[model samples]
Target: MFKIVKKWREQGTIERARGTGLENKKTTNNEDATLIQHLRAHPFTTATAAAQITNFPASRRTAQRRIRQISDFRCRVAAIKPFLTQQNKENRMGYAMQYLIFDQNFWENVIFTDEKVFQSSRNGKIRDFVLDSMKHILNKTIAVVDFPLMCGPGLVVGVPDCVGELMVD
Candidate 1:
């Protein structure tokens, strides 16, 4: 597919201005060009986890060739992934997409919300926390938790100390 597009480009089928980084090139489509431009603007280390998430189809041999020839695809995927993640978090889209499709009768009038607090250590050298199954297993179990508190209109709200609050059995 890309080869065909490249031939078309070389044969003057598509015309576009080459950016400073792109030099002169041909692409499979406008989408491919967009993807590549995004990549060049945002380069990624070959080891980045988002690469796995994006599921780029080419193999190592193809990567070496393509990285040399089609640098933009690599750049676009890397740049856009982090931006996508940041935007999703800002919009609360990607965090927890849990759909609880349950029996209506049981779920009626049930509202669910949660809160959590954590204690941290000082050795927080800034690095991206790479997530994998093993990491999920290691630190995710919680023995203590809390839910949102509600007070009636004109009622005083105050924090209770170590005893927490009334435990709803």
Candidate 2:
């Protein structure tokens, strides 16, 4: 309004006032660069540990804020995965290569089955009721005509002409 008009009349441009905060004096470019370098060296280091440096000594909160300002880095839990050795990789590759040579009919004949054992503890005795129940259910559903070929602990027997509707008990 009137103040704007008066200011505009006095000064050619209507820009806001500058240099009115402690944000600039908090940390310099050099300090930020040093902190970034330290973070790069030790990525898993906590803000509290990083703040203990002689050159860029600050509180944990301040250190975190500074780090955030530098990059889009955030803390996260590491995911667990199965450890595979060289032999494991080679074996996996060989298995895949063997399948590549075979036709689609080869896979149709293969009956893939997986079983998980659920352990339950009651009083002093460990009752494996879940595993027994699962096995019973599978046996009832799958009707074996000829001699069933057992692959592993949980069998993957190939039953010919018995791939109809499964009878669940």
Candidate 3:
């Protein structure tokens, strides 16, 4: 408290002075910028991987600290999102236009169902530094449903043994 009052009386402001703390001994400004650039290009790169790939002379802990110092990046769990191509978009538009004339009564007879595959044994606690949460990362794999198969009459769902390979029952 006495030191705080003394500094306040001396500087006429309570705000701390810039560049008063200890300097970084492991990495320099240019190296930090290079690390940041590498992370921006490949957000999934782990701290150790980034250090190795960027040829950072410091340890993995220093590299991690550098990443944490940057305000624009954040480590978060990736979200699942379906990726659509141009051909897929066109097909969807055509389907929508074809069904545009259908009335509410006609639509009432239709049933929509969605299926998602969950890996019970897989650990999904992976975290990556990303600039935007809206953009999908490569960590989460997305399998697109081409067309629904008809089994009996009630509802048919397609099961995938592997990605892009669907089996119907």
For each candidate, give its TM-score against the true structure.
0.20, 0.34, 0.44
Model 3 TM-score relative to the real fold: 0.44
lDDT of 2 by residue, 54-133 (tens): 26756677777877777655543323335657786566555545555778886677665444333222222221111212
Model 3 CA deviation exceeding 4 Å by range: 1-21, 80-125, 132-143, 146-169
lDDT of 1: 0.34
Clash count, predicted structure 3: 0
Error of 3 at 24 (Å): 4.0
Write one digit per residue (lDDT tens) for candidate 3, span 1-169: 9989998899888776766665546778888888899877666556677788888989988888888886467767656656768897567556545655879886564544434455431334455667655455444333333333243112223233342311111
What is the C-alpha lDDT profile of model 1 across 60-121, one tens digit per residue?
Answer: 44443444454422221211112235554444432222323446774443434333222222
Please give the CA lDDT of all the candidate structures. 0.34, 0.50, 0.61
Q: Candidate 3, which ten residues in sequence have the lowest lDDT sum?
A: 160-169
Worst 10 residues of 1 by lDDT: 72-81
TM-score of 1: 0.20
How far is 148's C-alpha from truth in model 2 (Å)? 29
Better of 1 and 2 by TM-score: 2
